[model samples]
Target: MTTPAPTALQRPDGSPLRILVVDDEQMLTDLLSMALKMEGWEVRSAASGFEALSLAREFEPDAMVLDIMMPDLDGMSVLQRLRQSGDDVPVLFLTAKDSVGDRVAGLTAGGDDYVTKPFSLEEVVARLRGLMRRAGTATAGGADPVLRVGDLTLNEDSHEIERGGTSIELTATEFELLRYLMRNQRRVVSKAQILDRVWNYDFGGRSSVVELYISYLRKKIDAGREPLIHTVRGVGYMIKAPQ
Candidate 1:
């Protein structure tokens, strides 16, 4: 038998990443915990949204896999509460509903990604890795540690951002999106490129996700300032210093 590939759950310094899996189903949580632990990650699970919220505060996981259709407090409520408390830990929603409306709702509600029911274990692992990476907690050390475009700055090491001498907070997904754009600086990146680089998913050619995030960045990064992010009509988007 061929040896299975290892799960990407360790930081560059060899520390195991912590992940919290929340679901009402015992078998599902158990299976997820087992698979996560097999990747050498610290795994925690909660059978209810209430327990999940409590554990989230205590565990402070690097990422969360949350089930939406839970009894009592639902995933949406849990996530909303966390956000209300200023917690921006990356979240991947697990739902039986795969409708566009459902996905949009989750994303709009601060979820980083989603996985439909009957997802492959490999796909879950991949999606979690992508979330961790975007959260800027996957790697320990790197060169250049910072990127700057005009007055806006992003420190990869600290996972902090500032614009025009003002500190700005960004969710994990937003940080990754801005980083990709600032890294490309003067180059206009197509929506397809942005999806591939930021989301690491084909998303079934759904370019609206990119548009939504760009609007988000605009409100956060460009509001009340000379816009650094520019739309290249009918093409994609670009970030560049003000002319």
Candidate 2:
């Protein structure tokens, strides 16, 4: 049975929310970016506090995900500067520090919410949604929960797939991989990017797993039909409608 589509938060003007993600870790940023984009939000990332501050001014994001510790500058100082500049964009801090004192210091320094290290993408998305809602900058995004490319369609709420008027079955992992590709239709996504976006990094991050799944998806999605998925040699893969 299909479940209800979870409402995605959006700007009051019915535009997708813009989010800024700041972290020194590239893997974390990639993962977070993928998840945020899937929710229909525009996402930008920075690798340091300085770069984050720069982007925040120009992007004027609806909300921010900030990492607390960095080599260049700390999250506290970044928030402090933003507050002093009269930009009250809600901030959610990511910290490896789990101490009460550290968290209190972050909150006291103008952070609106926070999650500790090794946090779930769901929690971060949820917290950002809450922040935007409370700030009156966001509301329910839209009614559609379907992603389509060519004749293929995937109902996010139903977890169902169909192509060329036929039903197709996918494992959980296959579903995620396909969803990522469809979301990025016509755009090449490297194996590393797919690994970060679709599978757990803890799975040893094997590119072969990506290869194996691509084959699985190929048999299910492309066999006996015009191929929507294509491989860019020495690069990655992309999905797009056939000419």
lDDT of 2 at 5: 39
Which candidate wins on lDDT?
A: 2
Show model 2 residue runs off by greater than 4 Å: 1-4, 142-243
Give TM per candidate. 0.58, 0.57
Q: Model 1, range 1-243, lDDT digits (tens) per residue?
A: 111232244666778899999999999988888888877789999999999999999998889999999988999999999999999999999989867678889988999988889887766876787688767768633345667887888886688899988999888899989987876788889998788568744578789999999999999999989898999999999999887
What's the CA RMSD of model 1 in angstroms? 9.5
List where candidate 1 sits over 4 angstroms from the true fold.
1-7, 140-243
What is the lDDT of every predicted structure here?
0.84, 0.86
lDDT of 2 by residue, 1-243 (tens): 122335777787888899999999999999999999999999999999999999999999999999999999989999999999999999999989866577678878889876888889987886787578668888765567678888999876578899988999999899989987886788899997787556423235468989999999999999999999999999999999877
